[model samples]
Target: MGSTASDEDYFQRGNLFWFTVITLSFGYYTWVVFWPQSIPYQSLGPLGPFTQYLVDHHHTFLHSGYWIAWLIHVGESLYAMVLCKSKGITDSRAQLLWFLQTFLFGIASLSILMAYRPKRQKRT
Candidate 1:
């Protein structure tokens, strides 16, 4: 059996630690922006004060940040799709997965795709 271009261009998943941390951070931001009243600020410890302050004094800031963050994620996801195509990741499933992961995890996912260096083929 021999290697194929698909094998060389397969997308790699990002690090578990980074993926988890980024997911949690995004979740927190979502909660803070959409359900600020439900957040137990004191329980957040150091982040509590900042979170409360933002919600109290600058809610628009939080709202803008949330939307902008998602917009950036959308842009990054599109770029990841392009990167997949350029790197010869021809599988539609792989490209869709890349887009979704990058949409959710942003740079955590895109960084992995960016780091990919397709294997060079031999000039037989």
Candidate 2:
């Protein structure tokens, strides 16, 4: 018996998705890290509502955005790990930069897990 899945029916395994996620992070970090001098800050122009709010509220916005983005990255990393398990895929770094990404994400995940532990309690 021969069976094939259509493009729509086909989906990537967990490892592939996690790998891709890490790869993208590696590339992003490399771009900003190695090319710090070459990278110019993109100007958002005159202070708009967001900038105005940040101004009115002070520098808290900057810290908030920074931390929020970091939290999001951490969440995505965890999601990738879960996805990898769900898809039964072995994740690996295709490039050296991926190593950095994995390490960084791993640290963040560990820190979060250490700070918060959730356990399922059996209903007696």
Candidate 3:
């Protein structure tokens, strides 16, 4: 089947949204991991207490990082559900699998879907 203009627009917008999400997630992770010293600890907002606790007690920055990664995973899982629906994936098992994979693997699961997605067929 041929894609209509609206369908193409929807596809482009979805792609752009996913790309933006992934880029921002990666950028935040990189900044936290590589240049954390550049971050102003005093202005960490809600994370200030946790950051101080971890620094003063544990002497490590891992707890905050773990929380951030967990938050990202949760967001990815929610996005996976929306993605499965948008892609017309009706099989319950398939949707569940993708959701779990996306939660566990993040953008890797999205890449897998893009790589293996079936091509649209032409109408006779």
Candidate 4:
């Protein structure tokens, strides 16, 4: 079989996107649930959707990590949909929310990765 546009030459680049998101979202989710200090709910507001999700799913979220992880997981899925679109994996089909979600996540992922990269010093 021949390669399709969606097959994509930028798989590594795209995967980097996914890895970054999964890592950050999953990490944040874990921390938020287990260590609310990981990301202060004050910023997003405890009454926000994620916190509400945590409260609603009290049984499974008994532990901070699981609840937080789930929150991240939902966000990431939405992210992945857009990642697919922006990367040309597929047409976004005029879906505003999908496009917005993908675009936001992609931008955030890149920004977070840039922020977290270790700085290097010249060894002259």
Candidate 5:
């Protein structure tokens, strides 16, 4: 049997959640990196000045966290490529686009993937 309308709606909602998450994450990181001073922290928040924050946090767990995030982005790119292949998406340009977008935007790209994914062929 094929997916019902409710199933499609459920998937859309899930995709929207993921897209929102990715957008917020990117916005937060951009703010933290480029505009930390404007964060309206009552006191110096977890990290102080951006430059000093990097210097002081180097070799600490926070440093590791940055590397971990980088690794996750790499993994996401790989996952996007694999997902396109598994879904039988044969266009090289589309595959490349998804891979790059997933690497840069993470779950935002996943939302796009979900929305545009090929419908499964029903077996007789």
Candidate 6:
């Protein structure tokens, strides 16, 4: 008997470009929140005007945005866990990976779960 790609115990890697973009965005948010003064806000090119306004006048709003972003990611991760369970991905490691990835990458991970169509065996 041969095992196909569906038979493999793993999750989809998802879109690489989106993953990189999101990871960089999360890192940038962290930097903006933690070290606002250290950032060359004016030299951020097209991002300068908006970023400077947030850092200079709306710092509290910026902090709220950071927390809200993370809260949304947490909500998405919980949804990913539910989606995995419904999809029959009962393996603990796979579920954990899904949760972590969804938490970190948000929709990048959830989109794959949304597209997944599990293969089912016919019983005689």
| Model 6: colliding residue pairs | none
Q: What lDDT would each prediction earn against the true structure?
A: 0.83, 0.41, 0.58, 0.46, 0.58, 0.79
For model 5, how does the per-residue alpha-carbon lDDT over 23-113 read when each residue is reduced to its tens digit?
7776665555556557654354754465456544543554466568768888887987766666555467667767777776676676566
Q: Give the winner by TM-score: 3 or 4.
A: 3
TM-score of each: 0.87, 0.35, 0.46, 0.32, 0.52, 0.85
Query: Please, what are the lDDT tens digits per residue for candidate 3 over residues 47-79?
Result: 666655555565445546756876888888787
Runs of candidate 4 with Cα error greater than 4 angstroms are 1-14, 45-49, 52-59, 62-124
Q: lDDT tens digits, residues 60-101, model 1?
A: 988998999999999999999888777767677778888998
RMSD of each: 3.6, 11.8, 9.7, 14.4, 7.1, 3.6
Best by TM-score: 1
TM-score of 6: 0.85
Clashing pairs in 4: 29-68, 33-64, 34-64
lDDT of 3 at 56: 55
Give a tens-digit lDDT track for model 6, residues 1-124: 1123542244777678999999898898888888988888768898977877778898888899999999999999999887877776766777888899899999889988777776852222
Q: Please report how far candidate 4 places residue 43 from its true position, in Å.
A: 0.9
Model 3, residue 56: distance off in Å is 9.1
Quote model 4's TM-score. Answer: 0.32
Off by over 4 Å in 1: 1-9, 121-124
Model 3 CA lDDT for position 14? 27
- The candidate 6 region of ten consecutive residues with least summed lDDT is 1-10
The top-ranked prediction according to lDDT is 1
Candidate closer to the true structure by TM-score (higher is better), 2 or 3: 3
In model 6, the Cα lDDT at residue 2 comes to 17
